[model samples]
Target: MSASPLKILLCALEPSADALGADLMAALRKRCPEAAFIGCGGALMAAQGLESLFPVDRFSVIGPVAALQALPAALKAADRLADLAEKEKPQTAILIDSWSFSKIAAMRLRKRAPEMRLIKYVAPQVWASRPRRAQKTAELFDGVLCLFGFETGYFEQAGANTRWVGHPGFQAILAHDSDKAAFRARHNIGAGPLLAVLPGSRAAELKRHAAPFRGAIEKLLTDFPDLRVVVSAAPGAENAVRALAAGWPGGAFVVEGEERFEACRAADAALAASGTATAELALLGTPMVVAYKVELLTELWARAVLTTPHVSLVNIAAGREVAPELLQRDCRPERLAAALAPLMRDGPARRSQIEAFPAIARLLAGERSPGDAAAAAVLDWLGTGKTP
Candidate 1:
C-alpha cells in the first residue's frame, strides 16, 4: 500500500512571507507530490494550494505600537491556528516571518501538538538586535531555515538545527530580465532621468512614508524638470501608493505586480524604503537612497536596541554603507533629495554603489535555488526526524 499523504501546515503573515511560502510550497510539492498544505497565508500561498486559516492582513503590522494595537486579534488568530493544528494534526508546521506572530503561534502549537515538528522559515534579526531571541527561537522550534549564511551561526550556537537556504528574492531578481524601454513605453515615460519610488509593502509603511517621499520627489522636480517618477506599489498597498503619488508635484506613475521590476531596472536611481526592496534594487544594480520611518516610541526603542550602524540589508551584508540610509528623523525631504541627487547623476557616488552590488550579490547567491534548498531541508527533517 502507498504511504499516506504528508500533511504540512504553513503560516505566512505578510506579502513577502506569503511569496516565500508560495515558493517553498511549490518546491515541496515537486519533492513530495502527495504532500498536503494547510494553515494561513495571503494570495500567493493560496495559489500554491494552501488553505489559509485566516486573512494574513489582520496580523501584518510593524513595530511595538502597531503590534500592541493588533495584539488582541493576533492572539485570537494564533489560538485559532493552534485549534486547527489540533484538528488537522499535521506532521510539520512551518512558520514564515512576522516573528512575533510566529512566536505566539509556535508556543500555542507546542502546547497543543507537542509531537509535531515546528520549523521557522526566516530567522529573526538576532545579529542586528535582540541577540537573546536566538536562544528563545532555538527553544521554540525543531529547526530553522536561514535566509542568510551569517544567520546560521547564531541559531546553531543557541542549539537549533539550522540550514542556510539563501534568499529566494535574490534568485528571482537575478533571473528576471527587466525591459527598461518596455516599462517606459508602457507608461509613456520619455528618455529623461527616471526615478523609482518604493515606499514599502504594508499599509502602515505607506502611511508613514508617503509625505516624506512626496516631499523628496517635489524637491527633486525643481532641480530636474524632466524627472519622471515611477512608484512601485506592493501587493496590498497599490491603492494607497497611487493615492499618495497622485499629490506629487510632477505626478508619478504607479506600477504594480511584475512591472515593478521593470521600473526598478529602468530607473536611474531609486528612493526606496529600507527592507527586502533595497536588496532587490541592489541586485538589479540600481543605485538607491534608502529611507524609513516608524512610530516615535518604536524609533526610541529601536535606537536603544539596534546594534548595527546600517539598517539596509545590502549595507549590513557589505559591512559598510553600500546605499545611503536616511532613517527616522533623518528621513526628511531635503536629505532624501540630496542623497538621491548624486545617485541620479553619472558620478562616483552612482558608480561606487553600482560597483559594490556585484559583491553583495555574490554574498547572497547559493549553490542551488533557495526554494529547492528549503524544500530539501524540510523534507530531510520529515524523513529522518532530523535537520540536514
Candidate 2:
C-alpha cells in the first residue's frame, strides 16, 4: 500500500513570518510534492495552500499595552490552534515568529499532542534580551531553523537542534529587479532627490512612527525643496500609511505590494523604522536614517533587557553604526532630518554607508535560498532525525 501524504502545520502571526512561511511552503512543495499544509498564516501563505484557521492580523500586536489588550483574543486563538492540531494530527508543526503567540501555541500543542514534533522557524533574539528564553525555547521546540549564523550558537547551547537556514529577506531583496525610472514615472515624481519613508508594517508601529516620520519629512523639505517622498506600505497597512503620508510637506507617494522594493531602490535616502525594513534598505544599497519609538513601558522594559549595542541589523552585522540611528528621545523630527541630510547628498557620509552594504550582504548570504534551506532542514529532521 502507498504511504499517505505528509501533513505539516504552519503558524505565522505577523507579516514577516507570513512571508517566511509562504517561502518555506513553496520550497517544501518543490521537494515533497505530496506534502499537505494547514494552520494559520497571511495572504502569501494562503497562496501556498495553507487554509489559515483565523486571520493572522488579530495577533499582530506589538508593545506591552497592545499585547495586554489582545491577550484574551490571543489566548482564544491559541486554543483554536490546539483544537485544530487535535483534529488534524499533523506529523510536524512549524511555528514561525511572534514569540508570544508561538510560545502559547507550542505549550498547548505539547499538552494536547506530545508525539507531534514542533519546530521553530525563527529563533527569538535571546542574544539581545531575555537570555533565558533560549533554554525555554529549547525545551519547547524539537528544533530551530535559525535565520543567521550567530543565532545557531544560542539555540545549540540550550540543547536545541539547530540549522542556520539563512534569511529570506536577503535573497528576496537581492533578486528584485528594481526600476528607478519606472517607479518615478508611475508616481509622476521628478528626478529630484527622492526619500523613501518606511514607518512600519504593524498598526502599532505606524501609530508610533507616523508623526515623527512626517515631521522629519517636513524638515527635509526645508533643505531640499524639490525632495520627493515615497512611503512603502505593507499590505494591510496601506490605507493607514496613505493617510499618514497625505499631509507630508511635498505630498508623498505611497506604494504598496511589490512597488515598495522599487521605491526603495529608486530613493537616494530613506527614513525607516529600526526593523526588517532597515535591513532590506541596506541590501538595496539605500543610505538611510533609522528611527524607532515605543510605549514608555515597553521602552523602559527593552532598555532594562536589551544587550545589543545597535538595533538595526545592518549596524549589528557591520559591528558599527553604518546608518545613523535616532531612537527613543532622539527619535524626534529634527534629529532624524539632521541624520538624513548628509545621506541625501553624494558625499563622504553617504559613500561610507553605501560602502558597507556589500559586506553586510555577504554576511547574510547562505549556500542556498532560505526557503529551500529551511525546507530541507525540516525534511531531513523528519527522515533521519538530522538537520543542516
User: Which number leads on lDDT?
Assistant: 1
lDDT of 1: 0.88
Write candidate 1's Cα lDDT for 353-388 as tens digits: 999988887666555788899999998888895543
Superposed on all Cα atoms, the candidates' RMSDs to the truth, in angstroms, are 4.3, 4.4
Clashes of 2: 0
Residue 84, model 2: lDDT of 88
Candidate 1: where is the Cα deviation over 4 Å? 1-26, 33-93, 104-116, 201-215, 218-225, 362-367, 382-388
Candidate 2 lDDT over residue span 189-231, tens digit each: 8688999999998778888888888888888899999998889
Q: How close is candidate 2 to the true structure, as a TM-score?
A: 0.77
TM-score of each: 0.77, 0.77
